[model samples]
Target: MRSNIDGKRLVDRIRKYYKADDFQVSDDGLSVGKDFYGLNKIKRVEVRQLGWRENAVNIVSLALVLSAATWAFVPQFGLIALALTFVIGFSCWRKYELRAEFIGTDETGDHWVAIARGCTKEEYSVFKEVERTMRNQV
Candidate 1:
């Protein structure tokens, strides 16, 4: 179930986050100090892929190691398996690019709202409405 979020409390929490070096509220709005998704500006899919891709690197390394072992531990070609795994892993990582600006709050101040880099005015207006309601509640 979804519910409305409080504004003063939200601002206070954001302040605390900024204080904790977890985030910072700037002229631009709230900036979670890092690239962490829970910091409030990234998508679930992007975050999920970031987590999964790192995991894939490890899994791929394991598989390559197993393959090398099956090949009688030939040292020369053993490095090839490792090298290819890393190359593939790096390419996959590249496709998971995230634009940090998309994760920030608006000038009107609504945290936890996710808007893409290029937003339509209509979308911004709707977000402002949500912010207005939340602020009014507090």
Candidate 2:
């Protein structure tokens, strides 16, 4: 998951992975370049909603963390439990609020997937906009 991604930085990364000839985003979000995955073709592009499977895992992990904090007090376990709790909590919050997935299929039948999960709202918005623009073109 990526967070606090600068729009300019994100664009730079995209350009780095995909050459100017390989991938291009139009000023109007109308025309788009292919050459993704060496399959210079675009079949369909859409913003996909990630299901509850991941969320469920986070929820369960959080629950287990709480239980550990309450019931387990081993000297070594305390620090580990606290750390795990913090991680799980952040993960749940991110999944619930910021992250979104965009998937595009190339003509050669390969899926190009990008996930945007940011800690800050501004970062999340930037990535979301990029995904939306790419989806609109296709």
* Candidate with best TM-score: 2
Which tens-of-lDDT digit does each residue in 78-107 have in candidate 2? 666666776656544443132223233446
Question: Relative to the true structure, how large is the alpha-carbon lDDT of every model?
Answer: 0.40, 0.47
**Candidate 1 stretches greater than 4 Å from native:** 1-56, 59-63, 66-75, 94-138
- Using lDDT as the measure, the top candidate is 2
Clashes of each: 1, 1
| lDDT (10s digit) by residue, model 1, range 10-108 | 544643211223333343343444533332333221111135555576558765766578457676676676676666544433212222323335575
Model 2: lDDT of residue 137: 55
lDDT against true structure, model 2: 0.47
Clashing pairs in 1: 41-103
TM-score of each candidate? 0.24, 0.32
